[model samples]
Target: MKLKIIAPIAAACLAAVPGAVAQADNTNFISRPLSLLDCLNIALRHNASILEAQRDLKASQGIVIQTRAVALPQLSVNGQYKDTERTAIESFGPPASSGGPAFSISPPVQNWNGDVQLVQAIYSGGRLAAAWQAAGVTRKQAAAQYDTAVAGALLDTRLAYYDVLLANQQITVQEASVTLLQKELEDQQNRYQAGTVPHFNVLRAEVALANEQPALIQARNNFRIAKNNLANLLGYNLPRDIWEDVPLNLSGSLDDRPCPVNLPDAIRQALAHRTELTALRETERLRQLNVVNARSGYKPDVSVFAGYGWKNSQFVDPGDLAYTLHGWNAGAQVSWDIFDGWLTRGKVVQAQALYKKSQISLADEARQIELQVRTAYSQFVEAGEVLDSQKKVQEEAEEALREAEARATAGTGTQLDVL
Candidate 1:
């Protein structure tokens, strides 16, 4: 019984041992080597910032549609009703109850009227046109903003992907170095036992191995963090995989691209393409319309109107009966704002100031775009140079290690010397 229980317990412990678990197949995580373009595509599809920008662009397009519809006819319904208990009237004849008949005698009167009417703006001096133009500008601006968002997301994905690749590469290098150092340590130990090498050789090898461990640990940490970062970039809740190689081949010299465009062209393109700038320009146009609308207060608004109505009055006498009267009226109406409180003038001034501010903002935004372009290009150039240098250095280190191993196998080098 004791033997049986001990065997079962041992089996259970072995079964509980930790091991690598298989991941779910639903995970579309990027595990294989991914190119920069692939990473950019992933970011564009999944990045939250890009999604938000897309939403904003959509909203802006909707606003454009709404503003454009301003040119169309507007329809509305209106109704009103009222009741009164007492009333007074003015009589041009004798007083009520004096010598006049009952019909002629003045009495409390009841009146009620109801009608449905429609009003539409026939014309405004270029206000609708300006508004529609502004909306179009806004739509264009939104498209530009979406482009900017895509570029930004792509750049970020590239940086994150490269970081992970670099970290993993460093981890591989450190692990290889650790293996070489371990083999050196073993060889030094054997040589010391044979009195062919000093004990310090073994100690040095061990120290190198220990130092490589710390570097390996740091690299693995960096790799994990980078993986998590990339997962976040892809809008994943968990990091199921990580691409561990630099996709860009860095085997060539870092040479600048020829005939780079100037800052003015960059700025011009940004002004022409940037959505925010275009949006501001549109806003400025809208402000101009606002100024026109404000100034419109000074002008007389003339309108033509026509309406028909019917009313019936009833009495209590047997001979009396309710009679219906129909009336139709048509006339021209005019509203002349001979004087106000300078409100229109104030609004016009405010609109002018806002428009001027928007112009300044547009100029500033152009300058900002120039700076962003310069910065992005500069970073691209620097990364290329650094990557090239690192690649060369890594290659040299690998070659040196290979040579060191070959010499060690030939028995012409001490263990420490080989390391």
Candidate 2:
């Protein structure tokens, strides 16, 4: 009866074995071997944040064009027609009876006029120049912001890729443990049948084997979740049926490279190379230009304008058309905003406040970046040490397991010892 009860449990455990082994043969889907650089490249192209940053940079370039337009000449042409029902005249001195001043006037029923005008700014205090400078600085800020976005995306992709690799390794480790327990269970059963060990040994081995099943299941689940997350990061919408189809292999190991040893040097490098700080500095420059622009209101603006036009009683030139009645005019003018309810003063105050705010923000960002650099350097060093220690432990465990199996097969060790 004991044998009968144990047979089905053993069969069930063996049935679970094929799943771990047959995963190697299930290759009906896409397979890609990706290195860290490969993943970074793919993310740079498809990541939503990076694409949005590129668009923002293009928008900043457009603003530069708009601001520069103030320094360029503007031209316009217009035409109009008018019809009159009657002509009337008023005399102030005398009428026809007095014969002092009298006149009869006839006016055309329809008139046409066309005009072309050009205006160019000769000077606007320093407003136009400062505005253009601010726009250029803003464009540079956008470029720097885009670089920061790319760096952030690259870091996130690296972490996700490492997660997938780690999960795959865990699955391998769990499978090995399950296999060892399965073998020990079988040996215990053989010894029980030979009447050389207690039935309790068989039960103990079965319990140990069963305990590994839950861990194996958990490891496989973790691996699948990790792969799915990576696929999402790569902008893939894979279906459940195709989960096993996409096989990913990483081309490198985490411990293959040496960590940076000098923490102070790393922090300095981060501060110098980080795009976020560059963007903040550019923002400060832009705010300074804004203050200059606001102060420009105190000075006068100078401009030159010219207009040429033609007018006639008829829409088309008459057959007799003497001169076409064309005229032209040109002049330069300067205008000062003597008073405007203290608006310029208010604008200057606002700009100064914003500039001060940017200064504080830049300082805060520098401190945060320094902290991040130090933390990352410390973690990198610690991880390298932990990896070395884990490798040694793995090697020792394998050797011990091998010796326990050899002694069990020679009937010189108990099943518990092998386990």
Candidate 3:
């Protein structure tokens, strides 16, 4: 029996063995005949999914900036120009002899106005503060998600690399078997020709070799497909419509390693370090902030604004309708939804429900992760036992083959056993 493993050999049981696939530097990207570490490095650098996750994390930072801006001072500059033919100047007097007729006093006069305003939030009943904190938590969630994406990419690269190795080994073993069968077939033919063995012996040997051809052909095709899979995981930028071998050769081999870490320690590590749990913890914090934000609606919102503004009427010269005016203004704002038709209450209730749900989800996820760690360790143990048995079985098979050959040569056994 053959054991085919990929990611778990390194990902789950890392540092448990003295030396295996875990000793190389994955950060070196320029080397040829890529090892597992090299493949992992390339996958992390070029994988589309990982890149997308990083972009998402950057976008979350923007969200954090926007939310925090709500609590900080805002400065703005504005300008406006207007020309109007109609005015109250006609009503100012029955007729204007100040210059010419009323028509001369007002004829599409130009006016300019400008303002520089500063607005600062004095209070928000905790709304702005909670929102800002929630945004920060959202960024944390994005960071955790990015970590998860990286971990997943590394695992996929490992699986693809292992697939290529497994298929290659299968082909090598099958070819060897075919060679031995071919020799047995030739010997059978020679013995039959000399009238020393029956024709049945020749046919049996031929059948045995023929049976291996289909499997051998399949193994070769599988090797090619596995290479393609590995190349895809490595994110090769190949031309469209071309099916080819991997650009880089693989230099790493799967060596059997020992598992020394116990199940309890594995579970503890998974709990402390799993990105999914970290992301969920961030979600729980975000939900708590949402509750605070909702409760803010019960209190009045307050802010203050100050501005320097210029209006045409302040220094308007009716003679030419030219204006050059500037002034300062300041005011405080207060808005209270003392009776909002129960809207605030409903919002608070909804936020509370969601926060409670997040708590339950976090707890459930922790349990599931613990169970997963236990299961994985148990499987690893079982696989080790099976591998030990396979070694013993191989030794027994080799000894049996030698005995059969000796017996056949001594004329105490049929050629069938050797074949």
Candidate 4:
């Protein structure tokens, strides 16, 4: 029953590769061997940080709609109703003929007015247009930010994947060493039992095996911790191995694949493709639009409106029912902000300052990206050199092992040396 539930969730997370997860043992251990692509696809869908960035992109699109609305026409409805009583009508007359029969004036008993209006903004001193453009640029910036988030998530996942691979490789080496030590200990014990070697040889072999045991244990523990860290980054719980008490199965190797690009080319590509720089460029455009929007406050706005309305007649006979009147009206409007205690000027200054700040930020970010690219290139070179040295060391170790075996076979070297 539990597996039925887990199977669906696991499938959804790794939907790109259906049936990647399955029951591996009777104890319900989930054995899923995920490759690098599988991990990347899962992270793109399920990672929390990337999901938040996606929401931000959607929100920015909404802002574009809102900003564009300001440049479009608007429609509205208005209604009013009024009821007049006798005493209220009497208050409009002068003492009602000096109290003669307590006479009073008469007004309409009830009246209603309604209208449908449409207003079109012919001009908004360029503020509306600039704001719309700014909104578009803002959306671009949000998209770039989303790209940046995706890139960061993928890079971190790659690093974690490599870390797990390294740990797994270390475990393999440790296990091999432990097996070799066990064989050596068995050989030493046999020699001792046959009275051909001293007890000290057996003791030495035991100690060597004991010393190797701790390293093997530590290596296995490291592998488990690395796998757990990877599972956390993937935003999912990995099913454990019930048979060996192990972790989720991973697929891939740590093969050396060096980047061939040089330092200058790398820096060039980083400057061109880095999402942070793209987002900043969009922000700079948005800020420039803001400056235009602020400057528009100095000019007047113009609009046109047309409406059709109905109302009861304004004047009627005292005891007669009021007649209804309907009419159409249209007009043009212009509004000027002649004075506001330098409010427009203040806004202009603030917008300009922010624009300048955006430019500075863009330049600084570009420089930072260049520096990072150069540093990474240097590190790549250093790592390549170290890898070359390690390869040479491995070759020399293999040659020494062969020489030791030959010496032991010839009876000029001890068995421990070859082991």
Candidate 5:
């Protein structure tokens, strides 16, 4: 019988050895307590998802720069060196009078050319402007996505933190239950020795204490698991023992404060403040700009270009190089894609279709947000009511336990009553 009880107890203690060792190994680190905001900050800085979102936002900004650069003046310098075999050039124009021989000339054997060219887009039929604006909108969308990531991380941290707190409270309640059961067992054993209660009473008390022990053990394990989960959300590695030893000191209870926002107000706030909605709006605007840019393909684009260059047979010109064998040219160009198998028309149609899709998506997202807000508000209210009723139940249970103990001490109650 002794081995039967001791075996399970021993197994439970052994199962808890790793956590105890972890706590002992980092006693000093475990002494500090983390607040909810501290966990949020840590997650924002180190969480992999949040970091990925930040990187995407940076890439979008780079794209904006790339698109805007198309409208700016472009300048380039180029140089060429050529080594050629000499060749004779002949010209005959109706046997130039005497017709002695056809005129012949030998060209230079080596040549060099260098030029600096500048091109400025005087007009692009709004293509460049629309593209740049679309890029800007995309950047804003990325920013909104990043905000959404942060908000999600914050919410996860809050939930995990509260979970750990809730687990701790449960452990406390289980431990208290175990303590009361032990005391009642002691009283029943004393009464059995005095012949006031039968041996059955002692056996019943022992069974209740045994049951409470396992419950308390399970609660402690759950508390450890909850803490580990919270640590993960705060970007700590569980295997590395970074937060394995840290004791969480949550300051408040789960339902300590009532939610002040009502259903309608909550929905209104979510619609106005939600980053998902903001991102969808920006995406819609970007798609609208894309339609404008596609239509721009039908219009003519105007641009001007100028180049200054020096070309000579020798690498260095010795006499009046600026005036001799130097060239400068400037010209303006106009280009219009009159037809391309209806390609521009196809592109405009595609963009318009995507724009319409985004409009529908935006409306759907707003509905989802409203649903989430209402569901959360209702749950919050229900939880508060449940907590109040549970508190009352707890008080009544405590009073009943007190009265049972008093009756037992006065020899007016049976051991079954206390149990």
Candidate 6:
């Protein structure tokens, strides 16, 4: 019994040791091999904002479909019923009093009728044509907006991803510094016991280690935050024990080069492709159509109508009693508004104002895009330059540290001097 308990406890302790060591190693290991394109691709599929924009685009497409349906014929069905009580009436004709007062038509000709009709708009003063154009433009606008959303989301993802990479790199630099200091501290302690170096040297090493600790901690925190952000974008709840190892790749200029296009060229591309500008232009066109429709109010409208009905003296006019039916009538209809109390003029003015406002908005959006593209391009290039500069600085720092160590080992350099 004693041996069995001891064996299980020893085994448990052994397993726990490896697990603890693994956890520590994993936290220190970080991956930095991802690129902007890879991140953008991931964001396109997973970013919530991009998904919402896509859904909105689909809804706009539905609207276009509804507008396109305007060309189809409209059909309607209608019915009516009537009841009457006998009443006498007089009739007047060419004889001044053609019939006695009580001898005229009675019961006011009771009737019932039902009919179904269809109307197809052959023309509408170019309103339908303009509307169709507007719908097409709206769809184009939606597509452009979706593209803009994708681009913006990709930019944000790249920024966050690189932030994490930079944090990890800084952490690595600090950790290496700490290792060197720890070795120096041990050496200083040994020398102090031997009376070869002052205790102050050992104290100095301790101070350096202490100073480096905070930076390392901060870097780790930043790394965790960055990983969390990326995980969120990928729609994951990052595990508490999550860790990654950096993948090494040879440096290539092709992967890091800036856009070669000039600012003017970029602006031109935006004007041609930006979704908001297209949407605004479509809105202006639609407003112009509204103006046309308002003006059309002054023009006359023409349509044809035809109907048939039956009348009988009997109360029940079933299908077999068709002999009591009358004939049918058909004619053209003409309606002219002639004039309203300035309502038409006010509508025209309102539409024109909206059209002018849309024009202004389009201009504003174009200028804004021009500014944004230029600014983003500048920032992108600047980040590359800064990264390159930091790389050189880091290399120089490492070389200097190596030289200092060699000189110190040769016994020609003091502890403070090497530091």
TM-score, every prediction: 0.67, 0.79, 0.85, 0.78, 0.80, 0.69
On lDDT, the leading prediction is: 3
Q: Give each model's whole-structure lDDT.
A: 0.60, 0.72, 0.76, 0.74, 0.72, 0.61
Which residues of candidate 6, in runs, are more than 4 Å off?
1-42, 68-72, 80-113, 122-126, 237-261, 304-331, 416-419
User: What's the CA RMSD for each of the models?
Assistant: 13.8, 11.4, 4.9, 7.6, 10.0, 13.6
Q: Predict model 6's lDDT versus the native.
A: 0.61
Candidate 2: 10-residue stretch with minimal lDDT? 14-23
**lDDT tens string, model 2, 1-419?**
11212111121221110111111122332264566666666667766667787898788889888877887888989898776664442324445887566764444555677889999988887887887677778788988999977766656666667778788888898999999888888877888999988999999999999999999898888888877766666655565677452566656454444423566766677678778899999999988988988898888989999999987733244322232578898999899999979999999999999999999999998887777766655555566689889889989988988888888788887676777
Q: After superposition, how far is residue 400 of candidate 4 from its true place, in Å?
A: 2.6
Of models 2 and 5, which has the larger TM-score?
A: 5
Pairs in steric clash, model 3: none
For model 3, how does the per-residue alpha-carbon lDDT over 1-419 read when each residue is reduced to its tens digit? 01212222337543211222322223233235667766776678777778888898888889888878878899999999876565533423335756766643343356678899999987889988897787779888989989988887777777777778889899998998898789878887988999988999989999999998899999988998988777766766554555654444677676667757676767777889888889999999988998898899899989999999986662246435454567999999999999999998999999999999999999998898776766666777787899899999989988987898788667788877876
Model 1 residue pairs with clashes: 141-275
**How close to the true structure is residue 313 of candidate 4, measured as C-alpha lDDT?**
70
Candidate 1 lDDT tens digits, 135-253: 76667667766776765665566556656667767788888878877888897889789997778888988887887788888888787777677667765554335354212221112
**Candidate 1 local lDDT, residue 351:** 83
Per-residue alpha-carbon lDDT of model 5 for 1-419, expressed as tens digits?
A: 11112111121221110111122123243345655555666677767778788898888888888877878889999998666654443332445567576563344455567899999887877888887787778888989999987777666666667778788889999999888889988988888899988899889999999988988888888888878776666665444455433455544354454335556755676789888899999999988988888888888989999999878733233222343377898999999889989999999999999999999999998887776666665566677689899999989988998898888889887777778
Worst 10 residues of 1 by lDDT: 8-17
Model 5 scores a TM of 0.80
Cand. 4 Cα-lDDT: 0.74
